[model samples]
Target: MHPPDKNPHDMRTAFRREFASPEVWITRTVVVGAAAVAGLVVVGFTWLAEQALGLFKGIASVGWWLPLLWTPLLCGAIVWTTRRFARGAGGSGIPQVMAALDPALSGGRRPLLVSLRLSLAKIGLTSAGLLGGLSLGREGPSVQIAAGVMLTARRWLPRGSGVSAHSLLVAGGAAGIAAAFNTPLAGVMFAIEELSRTPEQRNSGLIVSGIVLAGLIAVSVYGNGTHFGVIHPGPIGLALVGPGLLVTLVTGLAGGLFARLLLASLRGTSPDAPSRWRQRYPVRFAVGCGLAVAVIGAVTGGATYGSGNEATRALLDSNGHVPGGFALFKFIATWLTAWSGVPAGIFAPSLSIGAALGHDVAWLTNYPYAPAVIALGMVGFLAAATQAPLTAFIIVMEMVDGHGMVLSLMACAVIASTVSRVLSPPLYTALAMIQLPPRRTLPLATAGGDTDDSATRP
Candidate 1:
């Protein structure tokens, strides 16, 4: 029915011409280039965090009392630096990114949360936390830093372009997760689940392209290996069903309680004297937390330090056994570190705690599939803590290459997330709420210049 001049070949030619437009090409090129830069920056940040932790561990091994002396000093210095220079850079950094992505909450002050200076200070301070034996991770901070890089890079693009700052931030955050954990799919899922709640019809290609490009760059540098070494649980059978259900319940309860405690503390609901004092003097509170971490380290012989990567790796490898109290001590240490008002994250620590609990469960029950149990516990606890079941299970599954236990992992994540929701709101969302400005209403004035004083005026 078409005219003779508008043939199929002509239509194809027009399609190619539209696709080759400068604006389209420019936007695509900028997204890919920015993603690659984000990958490199995240890789570098991971390396720095590792080196800092290694150096601190080396120093701690030289003497038993060294941490007792150095931990307080490092804590004081980091707190002072954070307070004096980068007030907005403290904590896990996820909430700040969430706040930035929200327009009504950010109120044109998003840059204050994720500027170049804040990014640099986040790196330095989080590294310092690790060096001081704080039970924290670099992964969350990496998200903010990557977003900063991407946002900063967007300024180089032509003005009034199709690219949006929010899209860049979501892409950068997803890229950071990919680079940090080497889990590209999980990164994409996190972008959809946590960062961007928008429909896929809007900017999905740009977001996905950025994540893919960043993941490819990271793979080129770090090789295509899962974050955790491979664990083969053989074929799944009916026997694993019971143990898996038990792990779901246990981790769900534990993770839900942990989330509740954290939320209560952050909301100033803790009636304890120490909690009150900590709120009064945050600097002194930081030093006290550092000392407490040192004490835990000394008591555990350095078992409760850093991000618990070595412990988790050991458990995953099935070569070592953590002490019965390791998980409890680590939980307390991590909670205190978070309360210290410092720049740190709970990602790695939460995984380690979950792994330790799994090991304990396996030991007590004599479960034949310890690795499977551990993996389920990890997914479950993470799901409860973040209240993002899909993101939680996907990240854990990718890290361990546990495709064989997909159904079990999914079940555990769902149970844990449901339990956690009953106990508390999602952690990142609650924290983001804390950063938002409180709404206020101004009094209306009458035509005679007198303010309306009706108590129940609408």
Candidate 2:
């Protein structure tokens, strides 16, 4: 009687055997294939960006006249593209990612074409912005470009793929940032801190995959060197720690305030509102670029005109005697560059300015351990400015590659972040508020409220 009765499990076993399937292995193969393709695309994009920048540099070297013509025209083109295609690409594009991923904004509606066009627009505009001496950084453009690419690819997938697309876009963007700056950990941290604004992100698996792929691509191309050259152990002292902490707090607060002020100045509705720059089309941008170049050139002799990597190197190495208010000039240049709607990132420029400011503070005050103090300030100010302490700390540590600065960095980061919050929200978040619809923004007037509270917590 027992032998005569076959259980459902036995029937299923026979069915499984009949299929002759290797589901797990096949799935693994598919995953590996997708990852390989994504990795190649990321690397290729980064390489292209660098090449584009080199070409810009070559053209500009011919004469200062090139940028004079190039700045306004290129900026105008970027603005025009943003206006026509991805309205979200109008600013840094990070906020656009946040907006797209926001649950509140999704009325079961995701515009694939908008995303794709935005990415293309970002790449062109950002590259052109770079050529035109905009103070913006490449990380923003890289993220936008990656997001756009992934956005285009997701169009072929099923309808429910929007979430997946968003996650992948965010991951791809992180990879782009990681590759651009050669900071894999920072990339991952950024995805977690800034982009992964939901509980599901823990299991989404996209962040890890995208960051690792991007990091690998960056390392392969850049030979695993830290984005900034390693900092030599330069006169570390316990006495300087106290003063460094104070400076860090000030810088952080200033950074946050500066970011907020810039955002406020660049966004509005009325024709005469502070955000008139958005309405005037390219004219405001032309003026901004002209001013940035003029100020940077007149003050630093063009040394602080472009991205601040080379200048940062020189400043850190020189025991903190960079000329009169060069840091201040660089900060202004970056501010104007971003406010003018150039498609660029503030990541590098912000760090450069923070480092310079820190050094300047230490030098002026005759603070002991000037370099270490300044480095700490860099970490703190950057963290507060971006509202990303962990990413900022990791970035500075990786850039300098010295554990000696860790304690001071932490001190600076914490103080700066605390004070920064008191002053205003992070710059990018504030910028988002200005650019985003009123329904989309968190009430930034009050402090300690999470500006990103609308999105699910990462």
Candidate 3:
């Protein structure tokens, strides 16, 4: 009893008992296989989105007025398809995954939000929005798409497979985020912050494996490069406080306003003529929203269309060189795109808007740390918009390879999130709650039930 037996046969027997169990093998195979599949699926979606954007850019290049015609028609068709066939494939897609994972919802409703059909529909419809020059992101929708793939894998597994649906959902969604942005760390944080309320569960291994596999697919193709390349902003002395505060305040207010608008507009409680029309005739309203986006794109010389990836790059390359009011145009375009009832996301667009804001502030103030300011803008806006500061901060810091600005980025994220919270309840949480049954009013921990999407078209 003083010392445990060092018998080799007993040690081997115990090891086999733990590692060679049937449930262990099944869980490993099923979860890992699903993660790899989800990785491939997310990579395919990224390629499709890029191709769609390329097509839109090519056609728009032919005529400056092309998106004006192309966007409206295609967006109208997209909204029609989303409503008629895959009603659950609407919105940012993160909220849908969250709703499916919510314990408050019944199991029967889970399939509505995360299923094979919904994943396929989400990829197609979101790509359609991109092809039509809508200022939407595929990254947000990737959460639902990957989660759908993982959940589908659950059905193929045998009984007592060791992994719970909740674990699979969290892992797949986190994997999706990692695959989409090549940010495995953000994926883990997002799973903890937005996807799961019960973080005490021992799914750490599951979550890490999913992120690694899904993220590996992206790294295999892109060669492990940072998503937005790298940035070096020299040094920041005492000058950062004023300019940093300006950037944080602007992004915070702007992000909060964006979330507030999306809530009111999507909830059908805006009390505006556009909101009324959207509630009454959704497809027609989508057409109109598309028209607005096209006008913004044309006015911005096509800068306001697409996911703003290239624009953000150019902004990073050139210190605050974007056209005047570029952030405002992009903010409006992104909001309209989200409000159009299409299966798209505002995640990337929010980052793009923040970059514009940072650049504009740099222009106004003539700050030397333009790149740092831009990075701050990205984290601030994203954190404020999603109300997930850690995820936002990590995403920006990793994407830009700006680890040197870790403290600054973290501070900005916290400040922006605080400011945003004052104006709007959590955007993703509020949206997820609306996915619950209208009559039940389940005891979900959401800030606002005032937002009822039932009034809007599915």
Candidate 4:
């Protein structure tokens, strides 16, 4: 029988190869344990973030001008700490994870990009950014924090467990999204679309299991509640099509423009004064950025402060109107916060900006497109910014529990992402490339980021 044909494709052989190894169970157990810890960390991080926002609110209530003093000083302090201690904790933490996952770069820099100290700094400083009334979100930081938490387990895993460090990192990042957003499917999608930028993501089971295990914690705590509560958008009909198309276009342009500006701010294209300041006096630059945010918040009556969570929920529920020019103010505020080099996330702020834009469009058209339009705008902007359309739509769909609008959400995400690609390369990848050691073998030219010879610049 020629040794049963020795077929490599046999299901029985594959099954045995996967389950026969005892180390597989060991690896899975450790991963599960790490995911549980990551979930708890995220939960605590969320609470800390909320408390920071609450503290800021109390301070603002004391006086409108308080943010002017509070935001700038605290931002300067945060920048100083970041530069002094864990600089990797800065930004949303996504780019660091992306950089760490690059096989070419991971050899020497993984420790620098991801570690326990960095995770702790990320949690504290991200919350501090909120405390300073900066327009930042914790979700993006959570991704890095969770990844760091998971990476800590690498030393404990059994050898030959068939799980690479990359798998663990991907699982951790996906788990972070799951815990932060309470969307398991979206978490997996994000791992695939955003986190797993390399070929090392072949272990789908590990990633999926990590997401479920971690996401389950959020579901258990929130009692299966979504980030955005359920809001049923009416059936997709001809009347909705025109409005949806227009919204997609507007959000796409806005999202793409935001991405372009973000890249410019991150890595300057020209010898501009603000760009130079950001690179030279980062702490002072943060103060200026904080002051600018305070001014915007003061003018908008705090509409542009924090992650815009309340604003987004209000827009989705049509509870009340945010001040006029909310989208514009929010766009500027979020950009400034990123430019400040503080530990902050853009997720919720981006959604809020998209929500404001959608609301404005509905109002201008007088088309009675409140909640539905808002949802569309949210998905469009997120997709455009991240250039991860499927993940963007899934996250929104799960958040709003808008199964009724899934098709529309997907279409909007794809269209908006396409528009964004014209303006900028993928946001996380471009930023990650900048973090890596420049090699002559690597591609240097990007769409508009001009990352060519990035290591030499600045």
Candidate 5:
């Protein structure tokens, strides 16, 4: 029997029909997959938190040397594992993800392997890094771990399951952020705005669904109230105007300068061409850890280690009360933490430092507007340093329950974000350039032969 000939119109209509239904099916699948992944991330992060807190409490119970010994061993293990198993685990995995998203790197490696190893290493190293009194935050590292999990799933999953795996990865990442901050909405926003903004624009629906489910899990775990019970929402007044604006501007400058200086110093100190400080990565990190030990030990009396979440609680509870220069010490430790190539995050530590500085300002000035200033500074500096004002604002607001200070926070956020942009593009952007592939010109071919348009083609 002869095959029936199909008309162009019928063929086009058929193609459209085929393409249309799959989107709905894929979206539904993504939603369910995201929910499952969110649940998994919540469970994983909760476990990590409990383990970390228990470990730290145990260390605190013992003498000082216990932490020193504990920290180095853990860091050493993590570093060794990363070097041996997955080199992507060395720094904040966000940069690696960015690299992975680039068209150039996508086809090279599965990217999922890098994600999985980074995740495992981050959990072990970050936890251990914390115990060692290293100044780092879990939130940033959590992203790496979450991505790593997704990557592993991709590597081993059935060939046809890639789409579902990608969806779940996005979901897991959002859930990780939610669990880390105990703020689900912020996590969702971050996933959408920052983490999932890829050139391909492939998993928007899956990511959004995952973020929602992850947020629900976070809310269940942390309660509906704000992450920090910041009940004192004062009115916005001229009283806070002068000091608030001044500090915000100053902090913006300081944050931008600080981020640039720290990155530059870290870059310059790379031990190799790729990283002037790469060769010294181990030693530089060790020295940074030693310095963190010294500075945090001396200033906070051992209270300033790890992410400083507890310290932040203590500071806020004390109504902007903190030991003088504690903020500076924390900042220095954070710089060392990232620069040392330790598998960790600077985001939380930066928030902690900003809060400390704001508090210090309030305490010294004897100002009643301490909370506003502290809240503003906490987010302002973060916005400036990260160059993600929206994400910074949302994360900070959710963490501190800064709803009432909206006017002040927003004003400062705008100023600080603008200042940061003006000062430098963003820390990650500069770091990405360092890893950018060399440009190459490939010859372009027409249907019949090579074309001169090759040199001009992007």
Candidate 6:
């Protein structure tokens, strides 16, 4: 109807509204910016951690007792700083992220759990732990840090936008895993299995986009390659199947036991008096744990220190001659680190321990294909520890470039997860439950300005 000429300004406004709505623009910009920042943070943190570990190794090579003296002080300072400044920054950090994702607990505590302050503290303290030769990994801490970055970035979005905080948290954490391991699929699987208790339709696109963007950034910086060196097994023979099954069983039981022990220590349910005592004196306990790690490093000639990345890579490179007690020592060191109540992750250390166990198994059985066995052990142990078989197997498969061992790795992961479930509850879930307070009902105002039972119901 040509009743009146349309205003050019109004037409321009309509065109702009149609093409660049605030909701779409803000959401897209935030997601892309957050993912890019998260990728950069992960890459930088990883590089720093590697440098710190290399420096520590260099120092250890200079003298054996140096770590024994250096680690206790480093651990003591880290624990003290963690307690004094960022209490939420301690531990593997995955549990804290899980806690912050809960709608009930997230309102006020999200800032405390995942913020710039906490991210900075986590990166510094965790790198310090590595420099001290503590049996820890940076991967879990990276997840927490990335979540912090994304959450902080989301605050920059326009108010009343459609972007969801919960979705951003999930996407950020998944991106962290992708960047840390350079495995986009593993990152998505980790988000589905470990982070998201209930997958939502709205968050799926955000999750995938974040992962892809972050993975692209990581691959651009670090190049497309396996985290652990590649292994090319010539054939999947019948002879290896029996030993692979045996490796699966042994690693499953061991990994399950490790998880149980960690849960016991965290919950103060350990029957061991030492564990209880350590829980009481956390700082002293951390120092003691550091000392123990130093001792293990000495005994193993530094094979049991740091994230175990170098050792795992060596094994994957077909150098199967690890020390006789490397697996045992690494396990003990990692257990002690977990019990210490410091900022550390068990992912890389756990994988290294698994690889060591595999090497030991191969040595004992005189198996020719040590790398294949090691890969299987990595999947099994990680699956058992996290109780996420798909995530575990995907991470190991991606790390080792073992696409050929997909069926075998999957089998080991399923078996180990089943055995681990029988041994204990999922590690991250149990720890997250500990962080959440008991739910309470809030009273709502009635029409008559009076409180009622119905109004108080959650």
Q: List the RMSD of every prediction in angstroms.
A: 6.5, 7.1, 3.5, 3.5, 8.8, 7.9
Task: Report the lDDT tens digits of candidate 2 across residue range 1-458.
Answer: 36654544576776674344464334333333343454555566556656666676677678766666666666666655554554455556666665556555552333422256666666666666666566667676666666656555554444433236556656666766676677788788888888776635432554476567667776887787776667764666767755676678668877877767665555433455434444444445545565556456445655555567766777777543456777678777777676665566777777778888777777677875556766776787788777778878888888878577777676677777777787776666655443333464432210111112222122
lDDT of each model, Cα atoms only?
Answer: 0.79, 0.62, 0.85, 0.84, 0.62, 0.82
Model 4, 153-259: lDDT tens per residue?
A: 98888877667778878888888888888888888898888877554444567668877888898888877877878885766788888888988999999999998
After TM-score superposition, the amount by which residue 363's alpha carbon in candidate 6 deviates from its true location, in angstroms, is 2.7
Q: Write out the backbone clash pairs for model 4.
A: none
Question: Against the true structure, what is each candidate's TM-score?
Answer: 0.91, 0.80, 0.93, 0.93, 0.80, 0.90
**TM-score: which is higher, 3 or 6?**
3
- Leading candidate by lDDT: 3
Q: After superposing candidate 4, which stretches have Cα over 4 Å from the reference? A: 1-4, 8-21, 198-202, 440-458
Q: Where is the poorest 10-residue window by lDDT in model 3?
A: 443-452
Between prediction 4 and prediction 5, which has the larger TM-score? Answer: 4
lDDT of candidate 5 over 1-458, digit per residue (tens): 97766743677776775466665456556455645564566457556755775677677568765655655555555555555565556566555544444455444443432355456666776676666667777776666566555545454434443354445555556666776777767767766666554412454655566556666666776677776677464677777877787778867887897778656744444344434333435544555455555456545666667777766776667543456677877887777666555667777777877787777666666777566777877888888887767778888888888877766777787789888777776775555433334345332111000011321245
Model 6, residue pairs in steric clash: none
- Least accurate 10 contiguous residues by lDDT in model 5: 443-452
| Per-residue lDDT value at 366 in model 1 | 84
- Deviation in angstroms for 311 in model 5? 1.7
lDDT string, candidate 3, 41-141, tens digits: 99999999999999999999999998889999999999888877888888888888888887877778788788888999999999999999999998999
